[model samples]
Target chain A: MGRWQPGARERLEQAALDLFLDQGFTETTVPQITARAGLTTRTFFRHFADKREVLFAGEESVPERVARLMAEAPPSLGPMELIAEGLAPAAAEIFEGRSLDYLLRRRAAIDAEPALRERELRKFSLMSEALEQGFRDRGVDDLTARLAAEIAVTTFRIAVARWLDQHGDPDLPATINQTLAAMRHLTSHGGCSPFLTTHDEDHHRRDTGQLHDG
Target chain B: MGRWQPGARERLEQAALDLFLDQGFTETTVPQITARAGLTTRTFFRHFADKREVLFAGEESVPERVARLMAEAPPSLGPMELIAEGLAPAAAEIFEGRSLDYLLRRRAAIDAEPALRERELRKFSLMSEALEQGFRDRGVDDLTARLAAEIAVTTFRIAVARWLDQHGDPDLPATINQTLAAMRHLTSHGGCSPFLTTHDEDHHRRDTGQLHDG
Candidate 1:
């Protein structure tokens, strides 16, 4: 019986998450996920390599999309702003077809499973790597680019956490913006002259020149 | 033969790293490590649960020490500064009695294996958790405390990588300071008003009162 539905992949993921949440990730099996989705195990295999991959498949394309967003963003934007713009597409895409309840369930499953958590962190690490490369491509100093990428990713994690915690449907972009501002606040000196004031002019001038060339 | 040396644990770790590098992490066995250290298998078991434990044993105590440093740091120091202070002891302790060569080799062994890489990242995650708890204990706001801890840990990680890379024996503390300064430079806006200016004054006043009470 060769049967593959139009929404087989989404149905499989939704079914897998429901099963994982109903019992536990370790107890959930491919047959069970397929049964719940009203599909064959063969169809499930076609979509995901394994149960773990089901939760992580969405994250693979995220880095490429984010890097592209940053690369195409207006040159006048600062590194932090550019990163925020890059993250917007990811936020929208990840939560696009999923309901709030479905996302929460998915997050809960991930949280309850150590294997899933590791995969999640690894994906975030990959995203940071992509972001760092994007910054280097844009001619930012190596150290600054790396540090900025780390900060932006960290802020994104916090924003996602906050977005999930809200009682009602949350505004992910606004929450991310807030998280970025909070990160800036956490790192800033209290009422003191800005850090690296003397180097600012040279850095910005170089940044402008690079942007023009790009 | 029951020949257990004075610094059996350190000797075992050194032996393990050598074996790991000479062969590979997965190929190197408990007997090889013990034999290289001139110790019994029992001694290795007494020291570590397994070969992987040799690389991660010290991380368990790190959060406690770092949190203590942060809690006792001068009240006048800002949150970011306090976190840097908190991380100083960790840098010293990690490199204590370890040669630059030893550190590099240990890192190489860890890098060579995916299992070790996951362990390393998990340890870093634990460090961030500890730092966040320490900040909360110090009465910093939740979001700010969490973000501050993350930035500090990230900067520390970069510092460690850089310290390991330098040809000349580098000072870990100074490297950490440099990384912190670099992070500040990345986050700070040029000549703009400070982030959380009013909040800083209020937080400091409360912090001072808490210090006096302590």
Candidate 2:
């Protein structure tokens, strides 16, 4: 029972997700999880530090690998492109193989639970920090590095949302590229300055109306 | 006791900060805060919904003001500039009059506590959402608007950090302007593509190294 079997972790994760969905995260306990998995509490403890850890099991390694990839990227590549490339491999490894059902269920559960939502936000913050550090290591200034990191993360999120909607096509890289292209078009086409133009138009309209009245 | 007096809220905030600093946030209680402020526990509850709310008293109004400003901004301004203009008034109103000591102490306390840190992240996320909404209302696409909002938030954060270090000399608006200028320069200089170039260079190096060894 204590042996490190290949399917042991997956079995535990499946059991935990089943329990969490049937009974809310608050109502589920470690003993219940292990009982459902046909494993002892000690085995569960060995696999996960706590119940919360189960949800975040591979988070540590995923970010670490992405960061390493960014750091090892060629110095000549632009910041956004470097991040995009680095994230592609990890997306392929972690997200491409996964079933959409699990992700949808997990996302729904997190959205419903405040504690889980906070944890999820914290995870995104951690990822941003890692990306920022990667940029700084590559000689980007503080503000640019941080901004680039934010943009990269934002693009990744947009891509993931689109991918999820597509019923798990596993083309996260393509989705991210599409998002980046959209941003470029928006910025280049003067999308950012629309507010200024709108204000001017409003003022002109007011003046025209007054002239007509006169 | 339940009346909303003008200065009552400020007095309570001062007292709560003092108690939080003297004894850690976790160790301090509502009774202690009220006792220091020469008020009853009932008064504290009336002024602030909870102890955590004391730290975040006026923050709820910030996002609304920012959104309004963004919506009313001149349409001719670019997305980045539009966001900068929208943020300036709100930043001035919320952060301009605050003492450096108050800001530093509040930041330190929030950084030292995990719960407070999570709360801070959540607040930032909420603000980002509002900014995104403002952009969308102005005819920007969903993904572009979200990324612009995130970049704006990142710039605001960097500016605020720099402002906090100046010990009360520079105003929030000026600092924010400087940060925005830096971001514009960086973006225009092709900084975003560095990550991509770097990744490609690394790939090339790896391929060359393997070929040389072979």
Candidate 3:
């Protein structure tokens, strides 16, 4: 019951994760988590609303951090670069120092649990919303802001996938930067297709004639 | 019993949506839906496993249709163009001709219900997976495929939002095309930031020197 002490939440989280891995998410109980953490059920409840909450305790802070970072970024950086800078701290602080085995196991646990996956998706949605708002605040237009934010989220998700799959090689930030660069290349070169350039020409030619009927 | 005949599923869906809107999702019962639809509970069960399934009845077809469209796209079209073509049908089929009032109310109901929202997100994730697989089947690399599919989803979502918000202005296909074009501009100009061009120059300079450690 005295688990209000510093680091008690961390202990509870680690214990809950271990139990969820050893047994299963549904099979793991609050009492089991408390006992493993050397705490009590009361302490467990105080730290987390439920066992699942343990895995996502600090997630709410992510949007705020990303938004703040984006807001603080220098104006000279491009929208994509600003987003990259915004996410740099999260990549370093949350994903760094975690062993590959731990990350993969944690990912497995999350994948195996539907509720956790839903929660993760919700988190991603929230992050995207925050990023979109950040871009809008910087005077970007509505559609442009939304696209940039969504693309940034996609970049982050792909980078995380590569990082998790490849044992966190080159670190999260580097992977994200590389992924963004690839997207830039893909979009800029029109996927390097002459057919695309021809279509673009036709689209532009018709743009003044029929497309702006809006 | 006669509910097993034509359009029974659609009747059940319309009834469920009405009941959900009037009495709330949690308050609405299967019996209530059947009563409203002038059918039996057995018929309801035959059409849907439960009430929530009504809103998502035909959604399972979305991924298959999108994937099939992507697979059939001409190789001359680039990745983004292929995706845009894939989604052109959905914009016309699902969103066109729907009254703004009806669309807004439907969106409100889904937004108000947590379970429905979660189900929607899960459906989006599944669609992304199918699209990614479609790209992979066409010989795109893993990360590139994922990025293209995710970005396509982003384009679809943003276009839908605009359509829903502005009473389907510019129509669905046009909105999607415009959104994609904006993304193309954003990526090509690199947000028109001088800092980015310099970085790109440096990146090119170092491309053969130190970046290939990848």
lDDT of 1 at A140: 78
Ten contiguous residues with the weakest lDDT in model 1 chain A: A189-198
Pairs that clash in candidate 1: none
Q: Which ten residues in a row have the lowest lDDT in candidate 2 chain B?
A: B204-213
Q: What value does the TM-score of chain B take for model 1?
A: 0.82
**Most accurate candidate by TM-score:** 3
TM-score of each: 0.84, 0.81, 0.86
Query: Candidate 1's C-alpha lDDT?
Result: 0.77
Pitting candidate 1 against candidate 3, the one with the higher TM-score is 3
lDDT of 3 by residue, B1-214 (tens): 4534677887887788888888899999999999998888888888788888888777788888777777778866767667657677865665544566767777778988989988888888988898889888887877778888787777777778787887878777888888777887666554544233666646633531324544
Which CAPRI category fits model 1?
A: acceptable
In terms of docking quality, model 2 is acceptable
Order candidates by TM-score, high to low.
3, 1, 2
DockQ measured for candidate 1: 0.31
